[model samples]
Target: MKRVIQFATGNVGKHALPLIIERPGLELVGLHAHGPDKVGRDAADICGRSEPTGVIATKDIDALVALGADCVVYTSQAEMRPQQAIEEICRFLRAGTNVVGTSMVWLVAPQHADAWIREPLAAACAEGGTSLYINGVDPGYSGDSLVYTALTLAGRATGITVSEICDYGSYDDAEFTGVSFGFGTTPDHTPIMFAPGVLSSLWGGQVRSLADVLGVTLDEVRESHESWVTPEPIDCTMMSVAPGHVAAVRFAVEGIRDGQPVITMEHVNRLTPITAPDWPYPPDGRLGVHRVVVHGNPGVEINTRLGLDGVDHNDGGVISTAARAVNAIDAVCAAPSGLLSVKDLPAAHADRVMW
Candidate 1:
């Protein structure tokens, strides 16, 4: 059985714990939390499981690393603290623990990483003979893996585009919805997402990954974005937005080859559905959807809807983000010592037998 430890008890990590506990081939050995409040708590209790797992959450990273687990699911937030996240990941890898999770979405394919980021991770993997794989909803399966899988049916591909159109009003993270995305902020205030090179830093790797799969070399990666403000005040699950405040955002990362975009990943995220009427909407009219369009011979357009048993769109995204990491544990643990990506690992499927 594969022994796994989870880092952090955030939304993704909390949703992923029970999955590890319930999976037949995995054992939950350690739970690591950063804050004092969560430390010393039962793993199951932290995740709200009815029964307790003997493992307790600890703030001791060294102790957790010494547990000799097969893998560490590093689900801590990476966007704001990228350098720190990379340092922590390198530390875990050098301590001989394989890692697979959502931190450092660009690390999904390490080859695309800059020299400063790539060298240390490479050295760590070499030192301890461990591996690291990172993924999530947008840069994860929904954008890269799923789009590549759908391309198999195409005869000749001219252009490819994948879009994640969703409403973020129900998302519970105030810092994320308010400060990061500028959801409740004024129209002129730029959020981190709109910061120069931030989008490219987070998503350019996925664009390049697709290009590699298609055997095309991109001349450059370009970004475009537009934002809309609420005409009237609106309250969301996370925070309240005043009139003439940032409400919706539409952005795209395009891979250009020979001065034309050959591949593009776009996102139309909003706090309310009525804000961006001109932008694309989910076909089924669900709160969330991931759509892929292949512009070529026998062009194909596919739409993926998420919302089950009355779950909200943002909650559904969190579950999927967690599952993407949880399902890849076995594959990552079995891989050779190095940074692994979707291209390096096989298509991971859910353990339906355990269901």
Candidate 2:
């Protein structure tokens, strides 16, 4: 069994560690937090202690490293800059400890993460002979891995696009609400994601990844975003949302490497109590529509939804996605050294390992 050490004590880690402990080839070791106050507390305390583990949380990176853990799963909510995430990943890779973590958004996306973060991480992993993986749902699963999965249905395809649409009405966390759905702000206040350089930063790597699989070179990439606010105010635990519920955010990336454009677009909407009006709730809550449209000689259109019938995926989505953040620990250790993506590793189902 792989000895696994957790570097976070929050909800993200809390949700994952329990399941990881039960996996046949894995053993839960200890928990570490960047916070001084959390040090010395039982790992179960951090997770509400519905069950108990003797492990205590600590802030000592070196001490944790000395544990000779086969893998480290970082779930901390630390606000370290992008470079810090790279540094931490490097530390584990150098220690011969494979790493899996949820630190940043779209770490593998060619358009969003800085080269400084990427290049060093790759170098460190290669030098240490360890694998490092970064993953989550949206940019991680939806943006890249799912794109790769969708292409499986195609033969001699020209282009493809995928989108997510849903109502985030029940989500009440102010911090998350503000950033994700763009509450208390106008569309202009949010970053213009589709601009030339901007487009490449978001999901351009997905286009690049697909191109690599298809043996094509992308000549250019472009992207854009759109959001709407409800006309009146409604109350949730987080904030009193005005304008009703926000409209959808439509973000698309167009890859033009082969004289024609291959586009991928995402539509995210918080359309529950009041959505676009025509959209219906998908049993789970509101709705999330992932649509893929391919245009060419034998064109095709496909759409799917993720959450199960009774599962409220809004909150569960973040936690479930975060759980998968640690799902690649074994693969990260066994694979050749370097930065790895979810699709890069051998197949593993996160649901089977949950606490």
Please give the clash total of every predicted structure, in order. Answer: 0, 14
Q: lDDT of model 1 at residue 319?
A: 85
What RMSD value applies to candidate 2?
A: 3.7
- Cα error, residue 317 of model 1, in Å, equals 1.0
Q: What is the C-alpha RMSD of each candidate to the true structure, in Å?
A: 1.5, 3.7
For each candidate, give its TM-score against the true structure: 0.96, 0.83
Tell me how candidate 1 scores on lDDT: 0.85
Cα-based lDDT for every prediction = 0.85, 0.64
Model 2 scores a C-alpha lDDT of: 0.64
Best by TM-score: 1
Which lDDT tens digits does candidate 2 get at residues 161-254?
6666666655545565345546655556653343346545556766666667678777877666666666766665446656635443445566
